[model samples]
Target: MRILAVDDDLHMLQFVAGELRQHGYEVISAENGEQALARLEQQTVDLAIVDVMMPGIDGFELTERIHTDYDIPVILLTARHHIEDKERGFLAGSDDYLVKPFESKELLFRVKAILRRYDHPANNTLTAGSLTIDLKSYELRSPNGLSFIPLKEFELLALLASKPRHVFTRDAIIESVWGLDFQGDEQTINVHIKRLRTRLEQFAPDVKIVTVRGVGYKLEADS
Candidate 1:
């Protein structure tokens, strides 16, 4: 995927760009938000990583502009860990937030996760049998209209619905959805799958997320 990394600090910008490149992504570097905007005007980027502090056009404003102009997904990087900063980032159209001094692996994982979620074709809608997933709005409803799914539950459902009948090992599911950086164990995936199944039971009582004995989990669309 093509990514844009913008930061006033030349070293930081290069560092992030190099890291992303190492991960098999095409990366463009910019020294500030204005430069980043210029790059965007010339090329299409799958995602952008912007530092919050800059001399001209701070990260928030930059993110707002990108959202308004390109509808591009952005991941904000900031040294400031304040809750307010995070809230502002989201309000300004940042799809994700990463505090500075973050692990390279963590940064890569967040980038991949945000891009995956943003670009997921199954997002906003997915259908398997009578089940439907509203990924953009984080809602899942059944054909019978007897159930509602919460956000996390709906994420789990959407992940399964995207690849009908494909078995996803717990580790793979956690890495794909929760992200590789999530510290939770395989049991977390199990719990969410259980809850998702409970909600799905209301509409398609026979449809289920099945455990493969010693293998993993699979969504049984025909069940």
Candidate 2:
């Protein structure tokens, strides 16, 4: 699964990301909540591991935002281990809570359990207005015509189309489309998005890939 690991401390962030990666997870790290939110913009993630004691947006607020805006699970990581803190985490919409300096195995186990519990069928398709995304056939139907897209571009379209107006950050897009293990940079995502846009223009006159300057892209249906 793809996991977004957020922490202000560089060492802690690397440690957590490294540990998660070792267990075969695609791990993406952000320095703070702001960066984390930016990451969420460009990509679709399965789960998020957030640090509670960040400078700008704390873990609780971040968790709330994630739950409110995105369809992803969140796990709060904090140094504070009080009952009240745990309550706040849950109240903020965290699916799980992990105290800092935790064992790697425990984190792995929790991630596994949560994923299994929340897992849904991968064969499902999503539709937005006249734009039909066929997951099974890897085809996208639009007003202009039907376009049989490649697997990666199809995922890119699906992510953007899932929330048409939502701005996906380049980091977020790469994580969802390319996997967190992707060693490439943002240019790779840009390239894929450009090609996806070309395909849309050719076969989807009513649907367009709208670019949000200094952010990412989204799918906008012509009004």
TM-score of each: 0.55, 0.64
Leading candidate by lDDT: 2
Candidate RMSDs in Å, in order, are 13.5, 5.1
**Candidate 1 at residue 172, lDDT?**
56
Clashing pairs in 2: 41-168, 41-169, 42-168, 42-169, 42-172, 42-173, 43-172, 43-173
Worst 10 residues of 1 by lDDT: 163-172
lDDT by residue for model 2 (1-223), tens: 7899999989989988998899899888899999999888766677999999999898999999998888578988989979999999999999999997888889889988888876654546777667889877887887767778778888889888776667777767887788869988887787888897777667765778888898777777866
Q: List runs of model 1 lying over 4 Å from the truth.
A: 123-223
The numbered model that scores best in TM-score is 2
The parts of candidate 2 lying over 4 Å away from their true place are 9-11, 38-46, 81-84, 115-123, 130-132, 137-156, 163-208, 214-216, 220-223
lDDT of 1: 0.80
Model 1, 223: alpha-carbon shift in Å? 43
Shift of residue 25 alpha carbon in model 2, Å = 3.5
Query: What is candidate 2's TM-score against the reference?
Result: 0.64
Clashing pairs in 1: 124-136
